[model samples]
Target: MSEGKVANSNRAEQREQLSVAATATDGVQVLNPAGEIDHHTGDALRHALDVALTAHPRVVVDLGGVTFMDSSGINVLIAAHHALTQAGGWLRLAAPTDTVMRTLQIVGVDAVIDCHDTLRQALAD
Candidate 1:
Protein backbone atom coordinates (compact mmCIF):
# COMPACT_ATOMS: atom_id res chain seq x y z
CA MET A 1 0.00 0.00 0.00
CA SER A 2 1.13 3.56 -0.69
CA GLU A 3 2.21 5.67 2.29
CA GLY A 4 -0.52 8.23 1.64
CA LYS A 5 -3.18 5.54 1.43
CA VAL A 6 -1.96 4.01 4.70
CA ALA A 7 -2.12 7.34 6.47
CA ASN A 8 -5.64 7.96 5.18
CA SER A 9 -6.75 4.54 6.36
CA ASN A 10 -5.33 5.18 9.83
CA ARG A 11 -7.09 8.51 10.04
CA ALA A 12 -10.39 6.93 9.01
CA GLU A 13 -10.03 4.27 11.67
CA GLN A 14 -9.36 6.87 14.35
CA ARG A 15 -12.36 8.86 13.27
CA GLU A 16 -14.55 5.82 13.36
CA GLN A 17 -13.33 5.14 16.90
CA LEU A 18 -14.59 8.40 18.34
CA SER A 19 -18.22 8.73 19.37
CA VAL A 20 -20.42 9.37 22.41
CA ALA A 21 -24.14 9.83 23.04
CA ALA A 22 -26.63 10.20 25.84
CA THR A 23 -30.15 8.79 25.73
CA ALA A 24 -32.93 8.93 28.28
CA THR A 25 -35.46 6.22 29.05
CA ASP A 26 -37.84 5.98 31.96
CA GLY A 27 -36.06 8.73 33.83
CA VAL A 28 -32.71 6.99 33.47
CA GLN A 29 -29.96 8.37 31.28
CA VAL A 30 -27.85 6.03 29.20
CA LEU A 31 -24.52 7.15 27.85
CA ASN A 32 -23.67 5.08 24.80
CA PRO A 33 -19.99 5.54 23.98
CA ALA A 34 -18.12 4.04 21.05
CA GLY A 35 -14.37 3.97 20.39
CA GLU A 36 -11.13 3.91 22.27
CA ILE A 37 -11.28 5.86 25.49
CA ASP A 38 -7.87 7.33 26.14
CA HIS A 39 -6.28 10.60 27.21
CA HIS A 40 -7.42 12.23 23.99
CA THR A 41 -11.12 11.52 24.51
CA GLY A 42 -11.43 11.26 28.28
CA ASP A 43 -12.39 14.91 28.57
CA ALA A 44 -15.20 14.46 26.07
CA LEU A 45 -16.47 11.47 27.99
CA ARG A 46 -16.36 13.42 31.22
CA HIS A 47 -18.29 16.28 29.63
CA ALA A 48 -20.92 13.93 28.31
CA LEU A 49 -21.39 12.49 31.79
CA ASP A 50 -21.72 15.94 33.27
CA VAL A 51 -24.38 16.88 30.74
CA ALA A 52 -26.28 13.68 31.30
CA LEU A 53 -26.15 14.05 35.06
CA THR A 54 -27.56 17.51 34.87
CA ALA A 55 -30.81 16.19 33.43
CA HIS A 56 -30.99 12.72 34.88
CA PRO A 57 -30.01 11.68 38.36
CA ARG A 58 -29.55 8.05 37.46
CA VAL A 59 -27.06 7.17 34.71
CA VAL A 60 -26.09 3.93 33.08
CA VAL A 61 -23.00 4.05 30.90
CA ASP A 62 -23.26 1.61 28.02
CA LEU A 63 -19.74 0.50 27.24
CA GLY A 64 -20.59 -2.15 24.68
CA GLY A 65 -19.13 -0.10 21.85
CA VAL A 66 -15.98 0.80 23.74
CA THR A 67 -13.09 -1.05 22.12
CA PHE A 68 -10.35 0.20 24.44
CA MET A 69 -10.02 2.01 27.74
CA ASP A 70 -7.11 3.68 29.52
CA SER A 71 -6.41 5.12 32.96
CA SER A 72 -7.70 8.51 31.96
CA GLY A 73 -11.00 7.00 30.89
CA ILE A 74 -11.24 5.18 34.18
CA ASN A 75 -10.54 8.37 36.08
CA VAL A 76 -13.36 10.13 34.27
CA LEU A 77 -15.74 7.36 35.19
CA ILE A 78 -14.62 7.32 38.82
CA ALA A 79 -15.10 11.03 39.09
CA ALA A 80 -18.55 10.81 37.62
CA HIS A 81 -19.45 7.99 39.90
CA HIS A 82 -18.34 9.95 42.94
CA ALA A 83 -20.15 13.05 41.81
CA LEU A 84 -23.37 11.16 41.23
CA THR A 85 -23.09 9.42 44.56
CA GLN A 86 -22.58 12.70 46.39
CA ALA A 87 -25.76 14.01 44.78
CA GLY A 88 -27.70 10.96 45.95
CA GLY A 89 -27.72 9.63 42.38
CA TRP A 90 -26.23 6.48 40.88
CA LEU A 91 -23.81 5.77 38.07
CA ARG A 92 -23.34 2.27 36.68
CA LEU A 93 -21.40 0.64 33.88
CA ALA A 94 -22.80 -1.80 31.37
CA ALA A 95 -21.52 -4.16 28.66
CA PRO A 96 -17.82 -3.37 28.98
CA THR A 97 -15.67 -5.12 26.39
CA ASP A 98 -13.08 -7.67 27.47
CA THR A 99 -10.25 -5.17 27.16
CA VAL A 100 -12.10 -2.49 29.06
CA MET A 101 -13.23 -4.94 31.71
CA ARG A 102 -9.73 -6.21 32.16
CA THR A 103 -8.41 -2.74 32.60
CA LEU A 104 -10.99 -2.02 35.24
CA GLN A 105 -10.18 -5.24 37.02
CA ILE A 106 -6.46 -4.60 36.90
CA VAL A 107 -6.99 -1.21 38.40
CA GLY A 108 -9.18 -2.69 41.16
CA VAL A 109 -12.01 -0.36 40.20
CA ASP A 110 -14.53 -3.11 39.62
CA ALA A 111 -14.77 -3.60 43.34
CA VAL A 112 -15.50 0.06 43.91
CA ILE A 113 -18.10 0.59 41.23
CA ASP A 114 -21.28 -1.08 40.12
CA CYS A 115 -21.00 -2.90 36.82
CA HIS A 116 -23.75 -4.78 35.06
CA ASP A 117 -23.96 -7.09 32.11
CA THR A 118 -26.53 -5.01 30.26
CA LEU A 119 -28.00 -1.56 30.24
CA ARG A 120 -31.44 -2.93 31.05
CA GLN A 121 -30.17 -4.56 34.19
CA ALA A 122 -28.17 -1.55 35.21
CA LEU A 123 -31.12 0.79 34.84
CA ALA A 124 -33.60 -1.59 36.39
CA ASP A 125 -31.53 -1.71 39.54
Candidate 2:
Protein backbone atom coordinates (compact mmCIF):
# COMPACT_ATOMS: atom_id res chain seq x y z
CA MET A 1 0.00 0.00 0.00
CA SER A 2 1.10 3.57 -0.51
CA GLU A 3 2.42 5.65 2.35
CA GLY A 4 -0.62 7.92 2.27
CA LYS A 5 -2.99 4.98 2.38
CA VAL A 6 -1.13 3.42 5.26
CA ALA A 7 -1.20 6.66 7.15
CA ASN A 8 -4.91 7.05 6.53
CA SER A 9 -5.59 3.56 7.73
CA ASN A 10 -3.66 4.21 10.88
CA ARG A 11 -5.62 7.40 11.39
CA ALA A 12 -8.88 5.53 11.00
CA GLU A 13 -7.80 3.04 13.63
CA GLN A 14 -6.80 5.82 15.96
CA ARG A 15 -10.07 7.64 15.46
CA GLU A 16 -11.94 4.50 16.38
CA GLN A 17 -10.11 4.41 19.66
CA LEU A 18 -11.36 7.81 20.71
CA SER A 19 -14.87 8.52 22.00
CA VAL A 20 -15.79 11.77 20.33
CA ALA A 21 -19.41 12.13 19.26
CA ALA A 22 -20.84 14.17 16.38
CA THR A 23 -24.43 15.19 15.73
CA ALA A 24 -26.10 16.91 12.81
CA THR A 25 -29.06 19.26 12.65
CA ASP A 26 -30.43 21.49 9.96
CA GLY A 27 -27.41 21.06 7.74
CA VAL A 28 -25.05 21.92 10.56
CA GLN A 29 -22.86 19.42 12.37
CA VAL A 30 -22.02 19.81 16.02
CA LEU A 31 -19.01 18.01 17.44
CA ASN A 32 -18.88 17.48 21.16
CA PRO A 33 -15.55 16.56 22.64
CA ALA A 34 -15.01 15.32 26.15
CA GLY A 35 -11.96 15.16 28.42
CA GLU A 36 -8.67 16.74 27.42
CA ILE A 37 -7.60 17.50 23.85
CA ASP A 38 -3.87 17.18 23.74
CA HIS A 39 -1.57 15.33 21.37
CA HIS A 40 -3.22 12.02 22.20
CA THR A 41 -6.77 13.20 21.71
CA GLY A 42 -6.29 15.57 18.81
CA ASP A 43 -6.69 12.89 16.18
CA ALA A 44 -10.12 12.05 17.56
CA LEU A 45 -11.18 15.63 17.12
CA ARG A 46 -9.81 15.61 13.58
CA HIS A 47 -11.76 12.48 12.73
CA ALA A 48 -14.92 13.92 14.20
CA LEU A 49 -14.42 17.12 12.26
CA ASP A 50 -13.75 15.19 9.08
CA VAL A 51 -16.93 13.19 9.55
CA ALA A 52 -18.85 16.37 10.21
CA LEU A 53 -17.52 17.94 7.04
CA THR A 54 -18.68 14.95 5.05
CA ALA A 55 -22.25 15.47 6.22
CA HIS A 56 -22.61 19.24 6.26
CA PRO A 57 -21.15 22.40 4.85
CA ARG A 58 -21.58 24.28 8.09
CA VAL A 59 -19.84 22.68 11.08
CA VAL A 60 -20.04 23.84 14.65
CA VAL A 61 -17.67 22.49 17.25
CA ASP A 62 -19.09 22.61 20.72
CA LEU A 63 -16.21 22.94 23.15
CA GLY A 64 -18.15 23.53 26.32
CA GLY A 65 -17.10 20.17 27.74
CA VAL A 66 -13.45 20.19 26.88
CA THR A 67 -11.15 20.66 29.82
CA PHE A 68 -7.82 21.27 28.11
CA MET A 69 -6.24 21.67 24.71
CA ASP A 70 -2.76 21.85 23.26
CA SER A 71 -1.14 22.82 19.98
CA SER A 72 -2.33 19.60 18.42
CA GLY A 73 -5.94 20.53 19.05
CA ILE A 74 -5.36 23.91 17.49
CA ASN A 75 -3.79 22.32 14.44
CA VAL A 76 -6.81 20.06 13.96
CA LEU A 77 -9.15 23.05 14.09
CA ILE A 78 -7.01 25.03 11.66
CA ALA A 79 -6.83 22.18 9.22
CA ALA A 80 -10.53 21.56 9.47
CA HIS A 81 -11.23 25.24 8.91
CA HIS A 82 -9.16 25.27 5.75
CA ALA A 83 -10.74 22.10 4.47
CA LEU A 84 -14.25 23.37 5.11
CA THR A 85 -13.50 26.74 3.56
CA GLN A 86 -12.06 25.15 0.45
CA ALA A 87 -15.21 23.05 0.16
CA GLY A 88 -17.37 26.18 0.28
CA GLY A 89 -18.27 25.60 3.90
CA TRP A 90 -17.26 27.13 7.24
CA LEU A 91 -16.30 25.99 10.73
CA ARG A 92 -17.63 27.60 13.86
CA LEU A 93 -16.38 27.26 17.42
CA ALA A 94 -18.94 27.31 20.18
CA ALA A 95 -19.07 27.44 23.97
CA PRO A 96 -15.42 26.94 24.64
CA THR A 97 -14.49 27.03 28.27
CA ASP A 98 -12.39 29.95 29.44
CA THR A 99 -9.13 28.04 29.35
CA VAL A 100 -9.71 26.55 25.96
CA MET A 101 -10.84 29.91 24.65
CA ARG A 102 -7.67 31.48 26.01
CA THR A 103 -5.53 28.85 24.38
CA LEU A 104 -7.24 29.44 21.05
CA GLN A 105 -6.80 33.20 21.42
CA ILE A 106 -3.15 32.78 22.40
CA VAL A 107 -2.46 30.83 19.25
CA GLY A 108 -4.51 33.32 17.20
CA VAL A 109 -6.86 30.50 16.17
CA ASP A 110 -9.84 32.56 17.22
CA ALA A 111 -9.07 34.95 14.39
CA VAL A 112 -9.13 32.22 11.81
CA ILE A 113 -12.13 30.24 13.18
CA ASP A 114 -15.30 32.10 13.96
CA CYS A 115 -16.14 31.60 17.66
CA HIS A 116 -19.39 32.17 19.47
CA ASP A 117 -20.32 32.34 23.15
CA THR A 118 -22.98 29.69 22.76
CA LEU A 119 -23.91 26.73 20.57
CA ARG A 120 -27.22 28.35 19.69
CA GLN A 121 -25.45 31.33 18.25
CA ALA A 122 -23.07 29.16 16.32
CA LEU A 123 -25.86 27.01 14.90
CA ALA A 124 -27.89 30.07 14.03
CA ASP A 125 -25.04 31.47 12.00
Candidate 3:
Protein backbone atom coordinates (compact mmCIF):
# COMPACT_ATOMS: atom_id res chain seq x y z
CA MET A 1 0.00 0.00 0.00
CA SER A 2 1.04 3.62 -0.47
CA GLU A 3 2.63 5.47 2.44
CA GLY A 4 -0.35 7.85 2.79
CA LYS A 5 -2.77 4.94 2.65
CA VAL A 6 -0.86 3.14 5.39
CA ALA A 7 -0.86 6.26 7.56
CA ASN A 8 -4.61 6.68 7.10
CA SER A 9 -5.18 3.06 8.04
CA ASN A 10 -3.12 3.50 11.18
CA ARG A 11 -5.10 6.57 12.14
CA ALA A 12 -8.34 4.71 11.66
CA GLU A 13 -7.13 1.88 13.85
CA GLN A 14 -6.11 4.32 16.55
CA ARG A 15 -9.52 5.93 16.50
CA GLU A 16 -11.15 2.54 16.81
CA GLN A 17 -8.93 1.75 19.79
CA LEU A 18 -10.10 4.83 21.64
CA SER A 19 -13.84 4.18 21.75
CA VAL A 20 -16.36 1.42 22.18
CA ALA A 21 -18.49 0.09 19.37
CA ALA A 22 -22.12 -0.90 19.86
CA THR A 23 -24.59 -3.01 17.96
CA ALA A 24 -28.18 -4.05 18.30
CA THR A 25 -29.02 -7.65 18.89
CA ASP A 26 -32.44 -9.10 19.66
CA GLY A 27 -33.91 -5.77 20.77
CA VAL A 28 -30.98 -5.14 23.08
CA GLN A 29 -28.18 -2.73 22.32
CA VAL A 30 -24.87 -4.30 23.31
CA LEU A 31 -22.03 -1.83 23.76
CA ASN A 32 -18.58 -3.39 23.75
CA PRO A 33 -16.41 -0.61 25.07
CA ALA A 34 -12.65 -0.71 24.83
CA GLY A 35 -9.61 1.18 26.11
CA GLU A 36 -9.55 3.39 29.16
CA ILE A 37 -12.68 5.35 29.96
CA ASP A 38 -11.16 8.32 31.67
CA HIS A 39 -12.03 11.99 31.23
CA HIS A 40 -10.89 11.99 27.62
CA THR A 41 -12.84 8.96 26.51
CA GLY A 42 -15.86 9.30 28.73
CA ASP A 43 -17.66 11.47 26.22
CA ALA A 44 -17.18 8.84 23.59
CA LEU A 45 -18.74 6.27 25.84
CA ARG A 46 -21.63 8.58 26.58
CA HIS A 47 -22.13 9.26 22.92
CA ALA A 48 -22.26 5.54 22.29
CA LEU A 49 -24.97 5.24 24.88
CA ASP A 50 -26.92 8.09 23.34
CA VAL A 51 -26.78 6.44 19.94
CA ALA A 52 -27.76 3.08 21.35
CA LEU A 53 -30.67 4.54 23.27
CA THR A 54 -32.07 5.97 20.07
CA ALA A 55 -32.49 2.51 18.60
CA HIS A 56 -33.29 0.32 21.55
CA PRO A 57 -35.07 1.22 24.75
CA ARG A 58 -33.16 -1.54 26.47
CA VAL A 59 -29.40 -1.03 26.46
CA VAL A 60 -26.72 -3.30 27.84
CA VAL A 61 -23.19 -2.03 28.17
CA ASP A 62 -20.85 -4.98 27.89
CA LEU A 63 -17.73 -3.86 29.64
CA GLY A 64 -15.64 -6.94 28.94
CA GLY A 65 -13.14 -5.04 26.79
CA VAL A 66 -12.73 -2.12 29.14
CA THR A 67 -9.24 -2.06 30.57
CA PHE A 68 -9.73 0.89 32.86
CA MET A 69 -12.45 3.18 34.14
CA ASP A 70 -12.49 6.28 36.31
CA SER A 71 -14.99 8.64 37.88
CA SER A 72 -15.92 10.07 34.52
CA GLY A 73 -16.75 6.64 33.29
CA ILE A 74 -18.95 6.03 36.27
CA ASN A 75 -20.65 9.35 35.72
CA VAL A 76 -21.40 8.46 32.13
CA LEU A 77 -23.06 5.23 33.14
CA ILE A 78 -25.03 6.88 35.87
CA ALA A 79 -26.26 9.63 33.60
CA ALA A 80 -27.23 7.18 30.94
CA HIS A 81 -29.00 5.03 33.45
CA HIS A 82 -31.00 8.00 34.63
CA ALA A 83 -31.84 9.08 31.14
CA LEU A 84 -32.96 5.61 30.17
CA THR A 85 -35.04 5.29 33.27
CA GLN A 86 -36.66 8.65 32.72
CA ALA A 87 -37.67 7.46 29.29
CA GLY A 88 -39.28 4.38 30.79
CA GLY A 89 -36.42 2.20 29.57
CA TRP A 90 -33.53 0.44 31.21
CA LEU A 91 -29.77 0.66 30.96
CA ARG A 92 -27.74 -2.19 32.37
CA LEU A 93 -24.15 -3.25 32.74
CA ALA A 94 -22.98 -6.67 31.66
CA ALA A 95 -19.76 -8.52 32.33
CA PRO A 96 -17.98 -5.65 34.01
CA THR A 97 -14.34 -6.40 34.73
CA ASP A 98 -13.30 -6.75 38.34
CA THR A 99 -11.97 -3.21 38.47
CA VAL A 100 -15.11 -1.71 36.98
CA MET A 101 -17.37 -3.79 39.18
CA ARG A 102 -15.43 -2.84 42.28
CA THR A 103 -15.60 0.81 41.43
CA LEU A 104 -19.35 0.63 40.98
CA GLN A 105 -19.72 -1.20 44.25
CA ILE A 106 -17.54 1.28 46.05
CA VAL A 107 -19.57 4.20 44.78
CA GLY A 108 -22.81 2.49 45.78
CA VAL A 109 -23.81 2.52 42.14
CA ASP A 110 -24.15 -1.21 42.03
CA ALA A 111 -27.23 -1.07 44.14
CA VAL A 112 -28.68 1.82 42.17
CA ILE A 113 -28.25 0.20 38.78
CA ASP A 114 -28.95 -3.21 37.39
CA CYS A 115 -26.00 -5.38 36.53
CA HIS A 116 -25.90 -8.82 35.01
CA ASP A 117 -23.36 -11.50 34.27
CA THR A 118 -24.12 -11.62 30.59
CA LEU A 119 -26.01 -9.81 27.88
CA ARG A 120 -28.45 -12.67 27.64
CA GLN A 121 -29.16 -12.36 31.34
CA ALA A 122 -29.51 -8.61 31.15
CA LEU A 123 -32.00 -8.89 28.36
CA ALA A 124 -33.92 -11.74 29.84
CA ASP A 125 -35.79 -9.50 32.24
Best prediction by TM-score? 1
Per-residue lDDT, model 3, residue 86, is 86
Between prediction 2 and prediction 3, the one with superior TM-score is: 2
- What are the lDDT scores of the predictions, listed in order? 0.89, 0.88, 0.85
Candidate 1 lDDT, tens digit per residue, 1-125?
Answer: 69999999998679546588888999889999998888888887999999988998788999999988899999999999999998888899998988899999999888888998888888888
Which runs of model 2 end up more than 4 angstroms from their true locations?
1-18
- Which pairs clash (backbone N, Cα, C closer than 3 Å) in model 3? none
TM-score against native, each model: 0.90, 0.84, 0.83
Poorest lDDT segment (10 consecutive residues) of candidate 1: 11-20
Put down candidate 2 lDDT per residue, 1-125, tens digits, no spaces: 69999999987665434367788888888898977787877888998888888889789999998888889889999999999999999999999999999999999999989999999999887
Model 3 root-mean-square deviation: 5.0
Candidate 1, TM-score vs. the true structure? 0.90
What 10-residue stretch in candidate 3 is worst by lDDT?
A: 11-20
Arrange candidates by lDDT, highest first: which order? Answer: 1, 2, 3
State how far residue 62 of model 2 sits from its true place (Å): 0.2
| Model 1, residue pairs in steric clash | none
